[model samples]
Target: MARSDDAIAGSAERTRSVRLALASLSLSMLLPSLSTSIANVALPTLAQEFSASFQQVQWIVLAYLLAITTVIVSVGRLGDLIGRRRLLLAGLLLFTGASTLCGLAPTLWLLIGARAIQGLGAAIMMALTMAFVGETVPKEKTGSAMGLLGTMSAVGTALGPSLGGLFIAGPGWPAIFFVNLPVGLLTFVLAYRYLPADRKGAKTDRARFDNVGTLLLALTLAAYSLSMTLGRGSFGGLNVALLLAAVFGVGLFAFAEAKAASPLMQLAMFRNPALSAGFAMSTLVTTVVMATLVVGPFYLSGALALDAARVGLVMSVGPVVAALTGVPAGRMVDRFGAHGMTVAGLLAAAIGSAILPMVPAQLGIPGYVGPLALITAGYALFQAANNTSVMADIVPERRGLVSGMLNLSRNLGLITGASVMGAVFAFGSGASDITSAKPDAVVSGMQLTFAVAAALIVVALAIALVSRAVSRGVASTEPGAGA
Candidate 1:
C-alpha cells in the first residue's frame, strides 16, 4: 500500500513538471512573438515623439529584426553546446533589461539601440523554445506541445496591435515596453524553478564552440538583411555595395563552416531533402503571409477608406482564426503526417491569395475578412505541420541549431516579403506616397501584390509536393525510417 501511494505521488509530480514546463515555454514563445508586432502600432507615435522621418522611424523595427537575424543561429548553436535552459533564462533576463531600457530611452538612437538588444534576447528565446518543448515533453506529446506554442504565437500576434493601442492610450507609448516587465519576470521565475536541468552527458561535454564560423554567419546574415532592406527601396551605390558584400559573406561563411572544427550550422544538413524543402517552404509561406500583412493596412485605409481602428479590427480575423485552428492542425499532423497537411494547407493559402485580388473594394470589411481568415488558417496548418516534420527529423543534439535555421527562414521571408511586396506596390500604384494615393491606384497596387504573394505560395506548394514525394521514396526504401 505504501509503494502504491509512492507511485501515485511520483506520477503526480511528473505531471506537475510537464505542466510547468509547458507554461514556461509558452510564455517564452509569447513574449518574442508579441514583441514582433506590438511596436508596429506605435511607430507613428514614436516618430512624433522623436521628431523623426518615416525612413528613420523604420529603424525602430528594422534594428530589432536585423539583430535577431544576425545572432539567432549562433545563439541556437550555443544552446546546443552549453544548455538550452541556461540560454533561455539568460535571454529572458536580457529581454527584460532591454525592455526597461527601451521604456526609459530619452533619444531615438537610444531607443533603437535598446530595441536591438531586445531583439538579441528575443532571438535566443525564439531559437530555443521549440527545442525546449521537444526536450521537455514525451515524444508522443511533442506535436500537441508544439501546437500549443503555435496557438500562443498566433494569439500574441493578434493581440499586439490591440494591446499596443490600449497601452498607448492609457499609460502612453512607453507603457507598451514597460508592460513586458511583469510578464517577463513571471516567466523567468517559472523557467528557473521548473525547467529541467541540463544533462551532464557526452554530447554536452564533447562539443566545441566555433567562434570563427559564428562570426562569418553573423556577418553574412547582417549584410544580406541590410542589402534586402535598403536595396528594395532604391538601387544606389551603397545598396549595390551592400548586396555584393552579402554575396561575398555567404560564400565566406560556407567556406569557413566547411573548415571549422565544430561548425555553427552543419552544411551537410542541407543534404536532407526534407529539411531543406521544409526550410524553403517555411520562408516562402512567411513571405506570403507577411507581405499581405505589410500591405493590408495600406489597402484598407487607402482603398477602402477605413480608419485605423476599423482596419486593425478587420485585419485581426486572420490571426484569431489561426489561433483557433492551430491545436487541431497539430493533432492532425501527429495522426496523418506532415506531408499531406502541408500540401493541403499551402493549396488553401494559394487559393486564398488568388482570391484576395478579386475581393471588391466596395464590399469592404466583409469581403476582405473571409479571404484573410482563409489565408491565416492555411498558414496555421502549414506552420504546425512543417515545424513538426522538420524538428522530428533532426537529431536531438542538433534541435537547437535546426530551430534557429527555421526561425532564420521565417525572418528572411518577412524581410524579403516586405521589401519585394512594398516595391511591387510602389511600382503598381505609381505613387510616391501610398497614403495619399487615389483609391483606384491603391487597389491596383494591392492586386499586383496579392498576385505576387499567390505566385510565391504556389512555388512553395510545388516544393512541398516534391519533398513529400522524396520523403515517401526514402521511407519505402528504408522500412525502418523514422518520422
Candidate 2:
C-alpha cells in the first residue's frame, strides 16, 4: 500500500516537473518572437524621434533579423557541444541585458547594435527550445510539447503589436524593449530550476566545432539576407553582387563542410527524405505566409477601403487562429500520426490559398478573414506536426543541430516571403509604388500573389506525398516486410 502511494506521488512530481520545464521553454520561445514583431511597431516612432530616414530606421529590424539568421545554426551547434541548458541560460541573460541596452540607447545606430546582440540571444533561445523538448518531455508527448511551443510563438507574434502599441501609448517606444526584463528573468528562473543538467562525458563533448564551416555559413547567410532585404522594394547592382557572393559562399561552405572532420552540419542529412522534405516544405509554406503578411495590409486598406485600425484588427485573425489551433493540432498529431496530419494541413492550406484569391471584394473582411483563418489554422497544424515528425526521431546528440536547421529554414522562408513575395505582389499590382496603387490594382495583385502562394503550397504537398511514398517503399523493402 505504501509503495503504491509512493509511486503515485513520484508520478505526480514528474508530471509537475515536465509542466514547469515546458513553461520555461514556452517563455523562451515567446520572448524571441515577441522581440521580432514588437520592434517593427516601434520603427516609425524611432525614425521620427531620431530624425532618420526610412532606410536608416529599417536597420533596427534588419540588424536583429540578420544577426538571428547568421548565428542561429552556429549557436545550435554550440548548444549541442557545450549543453543546451547552459547555453539557454546564457541566452536568457543576454536577451534580458540587451533589452535594457535597447531601451537606454540614445542614438539610432546604438539601438541597432543592441538589437543585433538581442537577436543573437534570441537565436540561441529559438534554436534550443525545440531541441530541449526531447530532453525534457516524455517520448510520447513530443507532439504536445511542439504544439505548446508553437502556441507560445504565435501568441507572442500576435501579442506584439497590441502590446507594443499599449506601451508606446502609455509610456513610450522604449517601453516595448523594457517589457522583456520581467519575462526574461522569470523564464531564466524557471529554466534554471526545471531544466535537466547536461550529462558528463557525453559524445557531444568530444566532437570538434567546425570553425571554417561556421564562419563561411554565417557570411553566406548574412550576404543572402542583405541581398534580399537591402533594396527597399527595388533591386540594384549591389543586390546582384551580394546575391552572387552568397551563391559563391554556399558552394565554398559546402566544400568546407565536406572536408571538415567534424562538420557543423552533417551534409549527408540532406539525403534523409524526411528531413529534406520538412525543411523544404517549411520554407515554402512560410514563404506563402509572408505573402499574406506583406500583401494583406495593402489589400485591406486599398481594396476594401478599411482604416488602419480596421486593417490591423483584421490582420490579427491569422495569428489568433494559429494560437487556437496549435494545441488541438498537436493532439491530433499524437492521435493520427505526423505524416498524415502534415498532409492534411498542407491540403487545407492549399485549399485556403486557392479560396483566398476568389473571395469577392464586396464580401470584405469576413471573406478575407475566413480563408485567412483556415490558412493560419492549417499552418499551425503543419508546423506542429512537421516539427514533431523531424524532432521526434532525431538522436539526442544531434537534436540541437537539427532544431537549428529547422529554425533556419523557417527564418529563411520568412525573409524570402518578405522580399520575393512582396516583389511579386508589387509586380502583380503593376505599380511602381504599392502605397499609391489603385484599389483595382491592389485587388488584382492580391489575387495573383495568393494564386502564386497556392501553387507554392501545392509544390510542398507534392514533396510531402513523395517523401511519404518513399518512406513506405523503404519500409516494405526491409528484410522483415512481406509486402
Candidate 3:
C-alpha cells in the first residue's frame, strides 16, 4: 500500500515537471516568433522617424533574417555538442540583452546592428527548441508536444501586429522591444528552475566543432541572401558580383562539407525523400506567407487608408485562426499522417491567394481579412503536419541539426519573401512613397504579388503530392512492410 502511494506521488511529480518544462520552453519560443512579426507593423513608423528609404528600412528586418540564417546550423550543432539546455539559457540571455539594445538605439544603423545580434541569439534558441521538446516528451506524445509549441508560436506571431499597433499608438515602437524584458526575465527564471542539465559524457562531448564548415556555410548564406535582396531592388555590377559570390560560396561550402570529418549539415540527409520534400515545401509555404505579411500592412495603410491600429487588427485575424487550429491539425497529422494534411493545406492557401486579388475595392478591410484567415489556417495545418513529417525519419541524436535546418529554411523564406514581394510592390506600383501611393496602383501591385505567391504554392503542392506517392510506392515494395 505504501509503495503504491509512493508510485502515485512520483508519477504526479513527473507530470508536474513535464508541464513546467513545456511552459518554460513555450515562453522562450514565443519571444523570437513575436519579434519576427512585431517589427513589420512598426516598419513604417521607423522609416518616418529615421527619414529612410524603403530599401534602407527593409534592412531593419533583413539584418535579423540574415544573421539567423547564417549562424543557425553552426549554433544548432554547438547545442548538440555542449547541451541544448545550456545553449537555450545563453541564447535567452543574449536575446534579452539585444532587445534592450534595440529599444535604446538612437539611430537606424544602430538599430539594424542591434537587430542582427538579436537574430544570432534567436538562431540559437530556435535551433534548439524542437530538440529540447523531443528530449523532454515521450515519443508517442511528440506530435502533441510539437502541436502545443506550434500553437504558442502561432499566438505570438499573430499577436505581434496587434500588440505592435497598440504600443506604437501609445508608448511608441520602443515599447515593443521593452516589453520583452519582463517576459524574458520570467522565462529565464522558469527555465533555470525547470530544465534538466546535460548528461555527463554525452555522445557529442567528444565531437569536433566543424569550424571550416561553419564559416563556409555562413558565407554561403550571407552572399545568397544579400544577392537576392539586392538583385530584386537593383540590377547592376554590384548585384552581379554578389550573385557570383553566392554561387562560389555554395560550391566552396559543398566541397568543404564533402571533405570535413564533421559537416555542419550532412549532405546525405537530402537523400531522404520525405525530409527533403518537407524542407522544400516548408520554405515555399513560408515564402508566400511572409510575403503576404510584409505586403498586408502596406496594402491596408497605403491603399485602404486604414490606421495603424486597424491594420494591426486586420492582420491579427489570420494568426488567431492559425493558433486556434494548429493543435487540432497536429492531432490530425498524428492520426492520418502528414501527406494528406499538407496537400489540403496547400490547396486552401492557393485558393485564398487566388481569391485575394478579386476582393472588391469597395469592401475595404473585410474583403482582405477572410482571405488572410484562410491562408493562415492553411499555413497552420501545413506547418504542423510538415514539421512532424520532417522529424519523423530523423534519429534522436540528430534532432539538433535537423532543427537548425528547419529554422534555416524559414529564415531563407522570410528573406526571399520580404525582398521579392517588396520589389514587386515597388516596381508594379512605381511609387517612391509607399504611404502616399495611389490606391489603384497599390491594388494592382498587390494583385500581382498574390498571383505570384499562388503560383509558388501550387509548385510546392505538386512536389508534396509526388513525394507522397513515391513514399507509398517504396513502402509497398519492401518485404513484409505491413507486418
Q: TM-score for all predictions?
A: 0.94, 0.98, 0.89
Clashing pairs in 3: none
lDDT of 2 by residue, 1-483 (tens): 999999999999998999999999999999999998889888889999999998999999999999999999999998888888889999999999999999999999999999999999999999999999998988778888899899999999999999999999899998999999999999999999999998674435445999889999999999999999998768899999999999999999999999999999989999888999999999999999888899999999999999999999999899889898999998898889999999999999999999999999999899999999989999999999999998978987889899999999999999999999898899899998899999999998999999999999999999999998998898889898994
Q: How do the candidates rank by TM-score, highest first?
A: 2, 1, 3
Cα misplacement distance, residue 434 of candidate 1 (Å): 2.9
Count clashes in each candidate, considering only residues at least 3 apart in sequence or on different chains: 0, 0, 0
Best-fitting candidate, measured by TM-score?
2
Off by over 4 Å in 2: 202-207, 479-483
For residue 390, model 3's alpha carbon misses the true position, in angstroms, by 0.8
Candidate 1 deviant stretches above 4 angstroms: 202-207, 475-483
Measured on C-alpha atoms, candidate 3 has an lDDT of 0.84
411-458 per-residue lDDT for model 3 (tens digits): 788777877777777777778766678988888888888988899899
Question: Which prediction has more favorable lDDT, 2 or 3?
Answer: 2
TM accuracy, model 3: 0.89
Tens-place lDDT per residue, model 1, 240-358, is 78779989998998998898887787799897888999899999999888877878989989988899778888888878998899888888877887778888889889999999899
- Order candidates by lDDT, high to low: 2, 1, 3
Which parts of model 3 are misplaced by more than 4 Å?
A: 40-60, 104-111, 165-175, 203-207, 230-232, 301-307, 425-438, 476-483
